[model samples]
Target: MTPTTAFKVLTGEQMAALEKDGSFAGAPVDLADGYIHLSTFEQLTETVDKHFAGHDDLHVVEVDLEALGDAVKWEESRGGQLFPHLYGPLTLDVVVAYGPLHRDGTGQVQRPITG
Candidate 1:
């Protein structure tokens, strides 16, 4: 499936730093992996369920892939799906919208509304 945009799941602290600094290098895991991990709208729920379950103060930032240029690559990841990976720092300018990550009664993360 072709995805026009992707979402970055970050901690509140990381979001704050990105907003404050105008750009973010990478999260620890991203640093270790050499690229920032991102999830498509379809992948968000699973990403949250697998990685950020029971976590609080998390933020889901909508990203414009075109704005990121060629630095964004779709690489094979979980379940053999190709996930978006950013080779460079993430600039706040590319963020379309962001909000707190919350769960619904079924325990799945509520997808953030984005423009």
Candidate 2:
């Protein structure tokens, strides 16, 4: 089932760019793959550990999928799980909230609050 929202993980530069430019083309891997990768709330932890490990100044941004219309696609990846892929550049307007990566006491990364 598709969730109403998804999350994108960004490095400090990328986060700053998005904030300043009001949009982001994609990360290098996203550019190579032809889409922006997004992780569901449930998939956040492992996505960080596996792909973003050792990366500094990471941030997590909450995205409103409904606002993007058809741009968001759910495709099978990583053990056959459906991940959200944005076919177009990510605009800041669709990002309802964002903040530096933070983990709860349980060690799970927390999503930034909306509003």
Candidate 3:
């Protein structure tokens, strides 16, 4: 598996761990059901716009994995642990992150997928 894909899957698992441990700050967000919320970064951006800034006293930002360089930054920015969930039943080595979907029948993570 490519380094990129491996990381994506790792990110998903990390998210699950965080959920299970209930360490997320702010809201009690439960994301440990082993489901990947697939949406284009573009779609995520649109949703952010429609919500209106300061509408709910919460802010959202869509960041490219390419820009993430540290764990502290990721945890602080996303408000939760993020892990890659390999969409299909396949070898972990083959997973790659294709935006909100598997691009090359593989999945990758840009965040911690485990605690």
Please, what are the lDDT tens digits per residue for candidate 3 over residues 1-115?
2123223211343434434653322222224433233223323333334432333322221223323223212111133434333222222222222222122233221232222
- lDDT tens per residue, model 1, 6-106: 98889999988988998989899999999999999888989988988778889988888989889999999999999999999999889888888866898
When 2 and 3 are scored with TM-score, the better candidate is: 2
lDDT: the better of candidates 2 and 3: 2
Highest TM-score: which candidate?
2
**lDDT scores in order:** 0.87, 0.93, 0.28
For residue 72, give model 1's deviation from the true position in Å. Answer: 0.7
RMSDs, each prediction? 1.7, 1.1, 14.7
Task: Give the per-residue Cα lDDT of candidate 2 at 91.
Answer: 98
lDDT of 2 by residue, 21-112 (tens): 99999999999999999999999998998999988799999999999999999999999999999999999999989999999999899998
Error of 1 at 93 (Å): 0.7
lDDT assessment of candidate 1: 0.87
TM-score of 1: 0.90
Candidate numbers sorted by lDDT from highest down:
2, 1, 3
| lDDT score of residue 47 within candidate 2 | 95
In model 1, which runs have C-alpha deviations exceeding 4 angstroms? 104-108
